[model samples]
Target: MTLQYIQDKEGKTTGVIIPIKEWQSLKEKYSELQEEVEPSTELMSWQKKILDERISDYFDDPENVGDFERTLDDIEKSL
Candidate 1:
């Protein structure tokens, strides 16, 4: 597998990077480690619909811009 180096924002090399193929394989294995998880097309579609509705609602409500930003921050923190 191919590999490369990761860099910092200041253009300094930080560490080695795994190749994309290996990274994907690692991800699959990692997910498998969490055996409780299952594939869910229906949940994914529902989430997509909810996301689309929220985005459209954001555009409709100017006052919600700040709420949207805070929501994003909360989601990021949760991640």
Candidate 2:
């Protein structure tokens, strides 16, 4: 993608100019650019219950829980 630069009278870059087509493509590829998105602020009851169950399970079998490296390695190997 070629970007055009806008310079001030002092020759310092003041802004950038992306082609409309490229800008539209970028907006499509990146969700944040597509709109003003709001993130979920609170967990619903079912979500909380699921997390509580997971926590209880962890406490019940602390030794069996996967560490970060092991979990990441398992994911990567699966992929």
Could you estimate the TM-score for every candidate?
A: 0.29, 0.45
**Candidate 2, overall lDDT?**
0.90
Q: Which stretches of candidate 1 lie above 4 Å from their native place?
A: 1-43, 66-79
Q: What would the per-residue lDDT of candidate 1 be over residues 1-79, giving only the tens digit for each residue?
A: 7889789999899999887779778778798644544555565778899999999998898585666688999999999
Assess candidate 2 and give its TM-score to the true structure. 0.45
Name the lDDT of candidate 1.
0.79
Which 10 consecutive positions of candidate 1 have the poorest summed lDDT?
33-42
Once fitted onto the true fold, the runs of candidate 2 whose alpha carbons sit more than 4 angstroms away are: 1-39
Q: Over the stretch 1-79, how does candidate 2's per-residue lDDT look in tens digits?
A: 9999999999999999999999889888998876654567789999999999999998999897768998999999999
Q: What is the lDDT of residue 63 in candidate 2?
A: 93
